[model samples]
Target: MMITFTRILICFLLMVMFSNLQAQQLFQLSDDYIVKTYSERWELDSVYQQGTFRLMSYKPIYLAPVRWSSKPNDKPTSDNPDFSSTTSFPYNNIEAKFQVSFKTKLVQGIFWGKGDIWLGYTQKAHWQVFNTGLSRVFRELNYEPEIVFKYPVRWKFFGGQFRSVGLSFNHQSNGRDLPNSRSWNRIIFHMGYQNDDWIITLNPWIRLEDEEDENPNIGKYIGNAEINVAYNYHRHQFYSIITHPFNQIKGGSIQLNYVFPLKGHLRGHVQLFEGYGETLIDYNFRQTTLGFGISFADW
Candidate 1:
């Protein structure tokens, strides 16, 4: 069964990539200042004794205007940068991401019925093109592979209520072809309380061995904490997340996500994230980033 599932996933990924390739060419040729992005994510969880399994997959496409405004003194603006006064075309940024994850578990309960534990793995790939509409076009790719293990905690708080704890390991690095790669290893501890209508998760994480271009000392050890709140009303779901990063870099980020059903089996997601961070892949120092995305969702 695992083999069959893997085959199906591979086929789906190939089709998605092929479609992106076809669309990319057309987007590149278009005269209008436009940027396009795509993303895909998949997740699976199962329990053998409980005979329960869960699967989720999502794909989203985004299109945005490509224009940045700059001052006459040569200062660049943000995503929608202002180039109204000057003849120089503003730099355009384009990016895309793809992610997949799967998990399985088996459990047996003592007092009531049974409980289960699960393990999952996730892979994410991201591509970015900087200055798409300008003279210099720089492209970069990032890949992350992660693993998660989850187990249930019997009622310690209230009756008919349950808690879950999970441990996750993640490795992030640049694609092999990229000249400069930033890599990090992180270990995360997550605790969650779940009921029918609401779920709240707290994640605390630490990082070890941070490097840029494989340099050992260039990176700093950091700690991060995150809180996620999710509420479901029928088929619609709402979620918000707040993250705090500490150590050499100090800042926080907040994001809100909404999922709504669309036609057929398709669903849509509207998400926004705003925050300031010390370092982004290429930028030497800290910077602030504000962005929003619309995509397909399976929640």
Candidate 2:
């Protein structure tokens, strides 16, 4: 099954690359890409704007009413003996999942007007709304807050434009106590590139050790590096994220998202995920999930 999935993924990526060639010749960034994913995302075109309270979308915001998991981590455990859980919860395989993320500029034109700093926050939750037997409890929730410093770049790499580079201090946690608790801190470096309808981002992070660590083996499961690739074809969008791509032996995950135009700015979204770290509570658990929903914002 893994081999079959890997083959399909390779074929899908090849098709995207072929389509990208045609897209580059026919479409230009000046023609106004729908989302303007990279430029507007990083504020690459503009330096500083005068605003007291302006928040921007930092990641995709969507709610999936129907998300099915191949395996539910009813009894979550950790490599750290002290963090392992002995309790078991009645978690349903089907649930509702949603994510909300946003960012705001904190300091404009820092470091002699070469970079800007932003504060960002993201929250994700899994709710077993259909599992009324368990009183419709929330299965898991993860909170992430970060501070990033971004610098605009104009370098060219293999026919693509290197748009921006950034560094961020990120903190992610489930905000729970004891055996169910999960948290981590990282110093992440970011690099973004754009070529016509495609946008690529590379993130390599360093884990900051805690004296009272909750999940010391998190780096092995959650990974040290990740890559995001996005392609836009008219009103349709395709996105893929691969973590620990270079070192799959340590465990990795692949997430694919397809967004199609529905009505106006609303979009129909379909997501497929496999491998580990679907949620903080299930960080070391391996699973495959499929979700169908609507998307309000793009990453």
C-alpha TM-scores of all predictions:
0.55, 0.86
Error of 2 at 46 (Å): 3.1
Q: What's the true lDDT of residue 185 in model 2?
A: 86
Query: Number of backbone collisions per candidate, in order?
Result: 6, 0
Which residue runs of candidate 1 sit more than 4 Å off their true CA positions?
1-100, 104-140, 156-162, 176-179, 210-223, 246-250, 276-299
lDDT of 2 by residue, 118-229 (tens): 8777779999999999999888888777878888899998898998899999888887778888888899999999998899999999988788787877768878898999
Error of 2 at 194 (Å): 0.5
Question: Which of the numbered candidates is closest to the native, going by highest lDDT?
Answer: 2
Local lDDT at 292 for model 1 = 36
Model 2's C-alpha root-mean-square deviation from the true structure amounts to 11.7
Deviation in Å, model 1, residue 151 alpha carbon: 1.6
Top TM-score: which candidate number?
2
Give candidate 2's TM-score: 0.86
lDDT for model 1 comes to 0.42
**After superposition, candidate 2 runs with Cα above 4 Å error:** 1-34, 47-52, 245-250
